[model samples]
Target: MLHIRVITPASRTDEVLRIAADSPAVVNVLKLPGAAFDPEGDLVEFDVAREGANAVLADLKALGLKDTGGISVEQLDLSISTAAEAAEHAAPGDPEDAVVWEELSARTAAEARMTWSYFAFLALAVQIAAIGALLDQPILIVGAMVLGPDFGPVAAMCFGVLQRNVRLIGAAARTLAAGFAVAIAITLACAAVSRLIGWIEPTMLDDRPLTSFIIHPDRWSFVVAVLAGVAGILSMTARKSSALVGVFISVTTVPAAGNIAVAIALAHWNEVGASLVQLGVNLAGMIVAGIATLFIQRLMWSRLGRHDIAPHSPEVAAGQPTSGRVSG
Candidate 1:
């Protein structure tokens, strides 16, 4: 359920009240006149079922209340609500657990930001991959996957496309490209240093079967990538962060890219080409799967009556200044 607060001029109070009263989803409405001090206006507070929140919000928006006053829609956390027990005891398709697009987008964008920790994680991932290649160990390769930080921007890109938010898409793409470039470059340099120290042998690359995990490409590779992408998205949205650790372990992009760098430095063209193919396969699979998963999720949520909320729109609340408006 959602709690909507609208501050409107006394003149339009009737119109606003009528709109709220007419909404079938609205459960209770309260009007407090002269409730605010600065730019004083009447406050109309109301509650609506979660299933009808999007529709009610849309109707309120169409009323242009923001232009005349203030309007805000806040989600009521189910945990603290007096109705929590009832809500919890409800059936599986409970409206309270319905997906909210605005919340999802905001969370996704915030998580997508590239930070120092992200770089640190990527560096560790590359190192893990290099170690795995040097030791010809599959466990090390899986560890490298678990350490990779590439999923953030990839999932962000999928969310951005679903929301049609160009800025998000651009930011996610830039982060992804920059991170891979940096990881690949660092791995290549490390490979060079390792070669100088005689830590890696050219013959080892051809003899190691485990190394094929990063270099070999097959149909199953795409299937794994797709599964990882779905899991990645679910991990983010459902706040099951630990699931992401498993997702990393399932993708080979980081390992393959790292191996490609190592192969290049060691002058192993065959392995380099093979690893490059593996990297391509993993990347393509993740993107396709991620986008498809998001689409399906959105469709399911929409069918359950959740609609997209345009947070970036310029529309204002009634009794509030339309121009120079700022959201808190």
Candidate 2:
């Protein structure tokens, strides 16, 4: 379930109340008239099932409350009310299966930012993977995979494509490109310094038994990437952090990136080439599969939710703002 708080102008408060009262999936409606100080208006609150949220939000948005006042939504981790249960029962589908596009957009938008912490995590992950590659330690490799944060932007890029959001796509792409470049550069510098100090050798790349697959791209790599991509997007949309961890472990992007940095530092042209190929394969597969997964999800929800929404008033039916018009 989701909790919605709205500050609507006096002129639109009736319509807002009507929207909340009309939605079968909404309950515990409360309104405080003239309570808002900034963008002063009525403060309306309600709880709506996740499966029915998109429609309610769409209608509220159509009323232009966002421009006149405001709309805020927060997830309800626990709702013990019988009314909440009834609301869920009234909803069309399971909460976990619901795809709240605005929530997704907000999440992905934040993740796609090229913040300092983003670079720090990515660079640190690459260094860890590089060290793991030199030591031929699968355990450390797995640790690096878990620590890697590249998947966030990749998934953001996928969502951007689904929404046809050019600005979002550019932001995510730039974040990915600059992040990888910075991470690779850091790892490469660390490798060069380690080589100068006799801490690593070119031969370290040659005798890996368990970790050599990082540089050897084949059909299986693409297949695993595709599977991970699907799982990753689903986890994001469903807000399942546990499933996201599995997706992280399933992709080889970070390991391959580490291999490329180490091979470049050691002047192993063949390994570097192969690792580059592995990296490309992983990225391509993930993007392709993520986009496809989002497309199918959008289609499924649009069909199931078509008849589940409350009826639109004449104002809403006049096409002020249709469904899926506002992106976060």
Candidate 3:
């Protein structure tokens, strides 16, 4: 379930109410007249099953409420009402499979921002991974994999492609490119320092049995990357975050970057080239698979025959209807 809070202008309150009334998936509706001080409008709040959120939100957007007032949505962790249960049952699809595009866009947009924290995490993850590669420690490699936050921009890039949002696509692409550059530079610097201190010798990177895969790209690597991309996209849309960690662990992106840093510091030029190839393979595979997954989801949602609401539709949601009630 999702909770929606809308601030609607006085003139459009009825239309807003009508959208709620027409949907069996909306429950526990509340209307507060003149309740919004900043926007100077009425406040309408309701809970809707996830399956109906996209349709309802699209309808609300068509009404131009976003320009005149505001709309906000949040996930409902627990709703004990019988009305909530009925609403969920009335919805056409399962809650777990629902995808609220607006919410997703907002999330990915924020993720695409190249913030200080993003660089910090990426740099630290790469540094840890570089050390792991030098020591041939599979455990540290896995730890760095879990710690990396590269999936955010990757998912954003995939979503941007799906929606054909050129601005979003550019922003996400830049973020990915700049993020890796920063992480690699930092990790390389760290490895160079370790080499100066005589802590790591060039031969330490030669027979890295546990971590050699990080620098080797094969068909299996691409296959695993594609599968990981699909699973990562699914886990996110389904809101199963725990599963996303497994997605992170299954990919070699961070590890490849780590291997590249160590190889450069140790002057193993051939290994550096191979590690670069491995990184490219993983990224290419993920982007291709992620774009396909999102396209499939959009197609499936469209097949349900509930998309944009027509601006000229006659159904004006006048006042409260029997479908919903205002709390006194």
Which candidate wins on lDDT? 2
Per-candidate local distance difference test: 0.72, 0.86, 0.85
Q: Which digits, one per residue and each the tens of the lDDT, describe model 2 over residues 158-260?
A: 9888877788889999999898889999999999999999999998887989898898899999999999999999999899999999988888888888888
Q: How many backbone clashes does candidate 3 have?
A: 2
Tens-place lDDT per residue, model 1, 1-328, is 6788888888878877876665555656889998856457888888765555544555555566656677777866653544433322331244534454545666778657878888778877987887788779988888888888898889888888876779998998888878877888888888888889988877767678767667778999999999999988877766577988999989888888778788888788988888878878888888888889888876775555334343444342232222211011
- Residue 287, candidate 3: alpha-carbon lDDT: 90
Runs of candidate 3 with Cα error greater than 4 angstroms are 308-328
Better of 1 and 3 by lDDT: 3
* Clashes per candidate (backbone, < 3 Å): 12, 0, 2
Q: Please tell me which model should have the higher TM-score, number 1 or number 3.
A: 3
Q: What is the TM-score of each candidate against the true structure?
A: 0.74, 0.93, 0.93
Clashing pairs in 2: none
Assess the local accuracy of residue 262 in candidate 1 as a C-alpha lDDT between 0 and 100. Answer: 81
lDDT of 3 by residue, 219-238 (tens): 99999999999999999889
Error of 3 at 80 (Å): 1.1
Residue 276, model 3, lDDT: 93
What are the runs in model 2 whose C-alpha is more than 4 Å off? 307-328
